[model samples]
Target chain A: MTEPAAPIVILDKSQMAENIGAVARVMANFGLSELRLVSPRDGWPQERAWATASGADWVLDGVRVFGSVAEAVADLQTVFATTARSRETRQPVRTPREAARILYDDRASGLGVGLLFGGERAGLETSDIALTQGIVTIPIDPRHQSLNLAQAVAINAYEWRTLILDAPPPRFREAEPPAPGQLLLGMYEHLEAELDAGGFFHPPEKRPSMVQNLRVMLGRAGFTEQEVATFRGVITALSKGRGRVLAKLAAAKRQD
Target chain B: MTEPAAPIVILDKSQMAENIGAVARVMANFGLSELRLVSPRDGWPQERAWATASGADWVLDGVRVFGSVAEAVADLQTVFATTARSRETRQPVRTPREAARILYDDRASGLGVGLLFGGERAGLETSDIALTQGIVTIPIDPRHQSLNLAQAVAINAYEWRTLILDAPPPRFREAEPPAPGQLLLGMYEHLEAELDAGGFFHPPEKRPSMVQNLRVMLGRAGFTEQEVATFRGVITALSKGRGRVLAKLAAAKRQD
Candidate 1:
């Protein structure tokens, strides 16, 4: 059997180049080479990042840059965002070890996997997180939640390395690969457009959060490609039925 | 059942204050409070440590300084030293997760436990490692083994916190509490003295390594207080028997 592909490490809006370097060093330490950056505050190719990487040039040398989180994780089939605190999203939260196991299993099944980390200041935006499958929260002491950006990456990378070194027996059932992020994003947008037209989001001010909640709820389904197509078809059928009902009511009113 | 006591963190001969601060932050993040320093290079209470601690003052405030690793862990019943590379000693090497499970069980049994870390420049000395019952290796990629001191502490601390949060069912048989470090040290001294007089260490230059091996071998036994006492009595009886034989041989020579 072929070896599983290592999970891609994505840092979103990271401020410090030094932290990026530290992340790279840890990634190299854990045998993860793929790194993607989303709108780094200092921009890419910072010399300081190389300086702090401690000779982990392979990871930094091949870094990928993206303008947004959506583009950063575009091709990944399963992505988990690291969060410091619990958010209001309906997404399932997992520990680092648990997430690593899932990622290992997903990679073993030939699905691309990634881990998304928010910048040092504000973590991944709720809208950005809605695009992922689940949340990875390090079980830390409540009184002291000051885990820095690199440290967060280190713990995750360490867990991933552990799985690679000594993998546990696959306890989960063999399942269909989750649809790639791009396909899931398409389903989300399709449903959102219909919902918007139907005035399902009552308060204009609540539309953003409502959309996020809906997207998060659906993202947890781990939809396969066929499932995404079927769900979108279901949405299309419901919306067409609504249109037909409205046209009949209008004709009946005209006759009256 | 009462909550298990958190493991103490001992840094042996740490060099940088900032790394010490970083270690403190992670310890607080993982619900470990006790911090012991064995001969920090810059002495205690460096202002930079506080500045880098990111407001984890409680750990810094209660830091205890000792002259040596033996002094720092004198009261603890169980200690595991963290090492980046595997050593040739007979001590069992455990992954961070495994060590955390053992430490949790030991703590639950009312035994004082600690994690010993080496300095940033050089990891724990072999003699200091001999003081520990086992070695805790983080299991990083062998290609890149540049884990910094704080990162090492963070991984171990993270594992410990996981055990506290979602403790698994205790899987081991309930055993007697291990003898404290002081009692074990006494037994080691007694045995080594006898071995020295008996010329068990062949070459004078190899005495240090031989003594370390002996201590490490005996340390794994996790002897209880009663066991230590019994072992010491056995050593005394053997040494006395040797003395009687020597005295009889000398008297026989005089008659001749």
Candidate 2:
């Protein structure tokens, strides 16, 4: 039935309401709905969160709050903590992509899975991390290990969406198929006639090889019909531009 | 010796300095150093870019400016255009993961690889996209096809890094290795004793089965030493609170 992804995104002690808004926007971008806030600093229902959410009001409106990280994730069967540094804990750590892979399988099994993101300053404390089975650590500049809060959440959300939905490779169904060989030959002839009239066949002996090369190049491209028409329009523009240049040159000669 | 993994990151007519700075930061995160600015809106050496880059000064310092996309990617052996919408072009379209897989091979063969990121508003013109061999379209929210510019670059860089570096699975060195069965049993004994003293085993007959279930759950978790310690701490806190409540009841009886 293509159920929308419903993994709980638990934000622990998040400091900035604006960043919370950004997170909601990113989560919506990936179709993740469940949001749980644990001990937000400025308290819940911050107007700043709604203001910065842009069009992701649904995520903010449906959020649940909890007093502690343990209670926040009590219902989830699988949980992951995102921390910038490798901590001394039992849980396994995975890159965002790897974590998404595991989350995809766990979600398919109908067991609730959630991701825990720490506050703006220091990330998840060891006690909070101990509750989760795994950690998701994004590879960042070691010298500067922090990413903006929303960027961190955005990467994970993007990974999860990409894996589960399996977006189709791009195709242009609207485009008419490439021009037939015969029709392409006709285009070549027309373009060649125009070029020849414009004295493009200079040093006449080289003209045959040049024309043959041009034909081969066009054939290799397998240009679509619309593209061929566009090229024809370019030729028309060039011809009109040339006519204007010729008239200007004739006027100058007459004045001399 | 490991070569500095270099790929030309080309931003085609990017409008915002903040986006340019962000692109540079993401490129640096993946060890991609080459930056080619193709017709940026505010011209070059933007002070705002340096402010947003955080510590990616190297990318900004080595940036090269070009008048067009063609000029930007001229020296590269392979090029990819990242666009959200499907375009009618001869170029093959690949997911970022797929493109990274191909680029990984091409880069190993010593062929320079490059990516083209379009402007903030409309994406790369089809003519610009046609210059590349492949298109990388992130499967985004169909309704919200466009992504913040820096985000697109970050996802691609992550894929490339994961492929090349073989990021290690996270491990914690000091967690006393998953607690031995004997130690886990000891934790169970300590917690159950505390709970019994607090009358948590209420209606007494059901207590044994509930304890068994708790033991099974903890066993399934493969609790580590640190985690067990944390659970024990929670048990201690609850038991102490119960002792206080009992003392309060005795004190009230004496007052009566």
Error of 1 at A88 (Å): 53
Interface RMSD, one decimal, each candidate: 43.4, 40.5
Q: Write the per-residue lDDT of candidate 1 for residues B40-146, one digit (tens) a residue.
A: 99999898899889889999999999999988888998899999655565566779998999899878777889999999988889898888888898989999988
Tens-digit per-residue lDDT, B73-140, candidate 2: 65565678898655444455679988887676556555567889999998888656645666898988
Error at B72, model 2, angstroms: 3.1
Candidate 1 — which residues are off by over 4 angstroms?
A1-256, B169-173, B245-256
Model 2: how large is the Cα RMSD against the reference? 36.5
* Model 1: per-residue Cα lDDT over A1-256, one tens digit each: 4457789999999999999999999999988999999999989999999999999998999999999988888799889999965545556677999899989887877788999999998988999998988889998998998789989999999999898889665433244566788898898888777776655666789878867766764565566676677556545544553455455545555655
Local distance difference test, each candidate: 0.81, 0.70
Q: Provide backbone clash counts, one per model.
A: 0, 0
User: What value does the interface RMSD of model 1 take?
Assistant: 43.4
The positional error of residue A69 in candidate 1, measured at the CA in angstroms, is: 66
Residue A184's lDDT in candidate 1: 85
